[model samples]
Target: MKERHTSLLMFGLIASIALFFMLNLVLGSVEIPVRAVIRVLLGEEENTIWRNIILKSRLPQSLTAIMAGAGLAVSGLMMQTVFRNPLAGPSVLGISSGASLGVAFVILLSGSIGGVALSQLGFIGEVTLTLSAIAGSLLIMILIAYVSQKVRGNVSLLIMGVMIGYIATAIIGVLKFFSAEEDIRAYVIWGLGSFARVSGGQTTVFVVIMLVVLPFSFLLTKTLNLLLLGDSYARNLGLNIKRARLLVISCAGILVAIVTAYCGPIVFLGLAVPHICRGLFHTSNHAVLLPASLCAGASLALLCNLIARMPGFEGALPVNSVTALVGAPVVMWVLFNKRKSER
Candidate 1:
């Protein structure tokens, strides 16, 4: 009966997500009618501008919202499970900051160097930016992991992650101080967090990266389940805790980095979506939680994207702002409730 209920909830969430996606297609800056959008997509009408807006602008933006939502949510769940911190998330743990720093360097520093466009750096720049971001995130993850092993307190590790994030942000501020106006302006625009920045070709790259990381995360479900049983119990169950941790971190890192690169920093979907799913489904089991979070995240993201196009709002709210509004309240409620219950 419970299984059937979960299936029904998932179906309902997915249906809502699909409905919102079509709505996004219909409503935008220009407010194309739904019938016109369908006609444009079908190539039944010869409106080039409408066709371009639908195909080039709205479609990619909506697709970006889906991938970013799913990636960040899953990454958050993995980190939360690994660190055993409800607050553990890509943004909170300094991972997203690391990616932001990498992007800032390419956009700000490189651009200031007379004639060095990041695009001129080509595949090399892409590799460098991606690798540097990954390295920065891994450094923080490893530090937190080590602290978790040494300190014997979850709060301390979480605080340490917060400190790491601040440190990264401070470094970024220093970089900004020395950057030229034009480069700084470019970086600031990117920092506002839009789903419209990623091109169609880049979407293919993100999809491939996600596909690779998703399987590893899925395969680790058995280990993850045993993990929630505590280290000693997991060891007794023949799961190598170290290997499990490594795989989880690696998968989460890749997904987080990819989303950050493509969509800028998406805040809170990761931290909030998993908790929402847990409450709705009443299970910590990764099998159900993973898929449930995916649907919920996608649905919420599409909803937010739709709301972002609010009537008379200037140029849509930044994606991060929308997510933060949703995620922050959930975090506060969880913490306060947990504290009260503990008392």
Candidate 2:
């Protein structure tokens, strides 16, 4: 009976993802008819304006939301599991901070040092930000990997990660203080986060990269489940705790890095989705929770994206705002329910 229920819930999540995805393409600032959207997707629409709007804008944005949501949620789950803390988010290891610091240097420093604002450089600016974010995140990830091997305790490693984040934030703050007003404004906009930030061929590459990396997470499900049994027991069962910790951290760090590189530092989805999945499925098993988080994350992100672009507001709201507003309540509800059940 429980298995059947879980299956139904999974089905519901997938259905919601599809519904929201279609709604995203159909309902935007300029209303496109459902039929027209379908026709455009099917390559039967002849109206170039509607076609371009759907293909060039909505399609890529929706895809980006999916990939970003799934990647972040999975990364969060891994972080929580490895650290044994429900509050352990994808950003807990400072990978996102590293990415942000990189962008800070590019957007903040270019104005002060180069005498030319990189933010005004258009495509060149965007490319530079993406690359810098990747480089910064990977660099931190490498450092974390090294520290993981040196430090035997997860707590020690976690503390080091937090200190690294603080150091990065301090550097970014110093840069922002010295940066020009326009550069600071540009940096703030990027910090707000946006699915629309990625478009055209970039969207395809982002989705493809996520598709490649996400499946590798599933491969760690068993390792994750064993880790849940605690280090001593897991070791008794022949699990290499050190190696497993490194792999999980590496996997989660890479996921966070990639998503942050492309989408900016999207919050809440990573921290909330795993809890949402656990509440829905009522299980700690990674095999179940992992996929559940993936689908739930995609659906939630699509819903947030849809709301952000809903017809009321001109342009679109920042994705980070919508996510925090939507995700915070859900997380609170899950926690409330869990506490009530315990009582």
Candidate 3:
């Protein structure tokens, strides 16, 4: 019965994801008929404009949102499980800040030297931004991993992550201060976060990276489940606590880095989705929660993308705003009720 219920829930979530994904294709800046979207996807659409919009824009954006949301949410679940803290996340740990700092250098420094708009640099711009994010995030991730090895206390490690994020932000602020207005505006737009920013080619690369990394994360399911039993117990069970911690953190950090590089610092999906999955399935098992978080994350992101691009808005709203807006209330409601039940 329990397994049956879980299967039903998973099916429901997948159905919702599919529905939202289709809606995203159909209801963009210019609403196309659902049938037209189907025809375009099937290579039968006669209108090049509709075909282009569906193929080149909405499709890529939806795919980006799917991967970004799933990756971040799963990373968040791993962090919360490893750190044993409900609040620890990619942004909270300064990893996203590091990526942002890296992008800031590319945008601010490049603009300070060359007058060309970073956004207008096309494919070259995407590579530059991605490389910058990878460098910045990996630097912070290495620091955090080193600190994890040294710091005996999880709280201390958590605090160190927050401090690193602040340091990254401080550096970015300095870069922005001396940068040109146009560069600053570009950086600001990037910071606001948009799934639509990624081109079809970029989206393919992003999806490929995510596909490789996500499977590795799932293979760590045993390690994650073991860690929940406390360090001593897990160690007694022959788990190398330090190695496991470092491995999980590195994987999670890489996931965050990639998503932040491509999608911007997507805030709450990572932090909130784990909690939502846990509540829905009523399971602490990584085996279940990991996949559940992935599905829930993808569904929420597609929904957010849809709302951001809804008719009246004409996709004017930033994706970060919608995710944060929707995520914050959902988390608050769950936490509040959880505390109430605990009392």
Highest-scoring model, TM-score = 2
Show model 2 residue runs off by greater than 4 Å: 341-343
- In order, the Cα lDDT scores of the candidates are 0.76, 0.93, 0.91
Ranking by lDDT: 2, 3, 1
Predicted structure 3: lDDT: 0.91
Of 2 and 3, the candidate ranking higher by TM-score: 2
Candidate 1: give the clashing pairs.
none
Q: Compose the digit string of candidate 1's lDDT tens values, residues 1-343.
A: 9999888988998998889899989887688888888898788867788888888888877888887888888888888887787778867767778777777766667866756756457556655555665665666666655655566444665677678788888988988898877777767766777777776666676767776776677887887788788778888999877677767766787778778777777777888998888767768999998888777888888877877776765365887788778667865776566567666
How many clashes does the backbone of model 1 have? 0
Model 2 residue 302 lDDT?
A: 94
Off by over 4 Å in 3: 114-117, 336-343
Worst 10 residues of 3 by lDDT: 334-343
Residue 26 lDDT, candidate 2, scale 0-100 = 89
What ranking emerges by TM-score with the best candidate at the front?
2, 3, 1
Model 3 TM-score is 0.96
Per-prediction TM-score:
0.85, 0.97, 0.96
For candidate 2, the per-residue lDDT at 104 reads: 94
Give the local distance difference test score of model 1.
Answer: 0.76
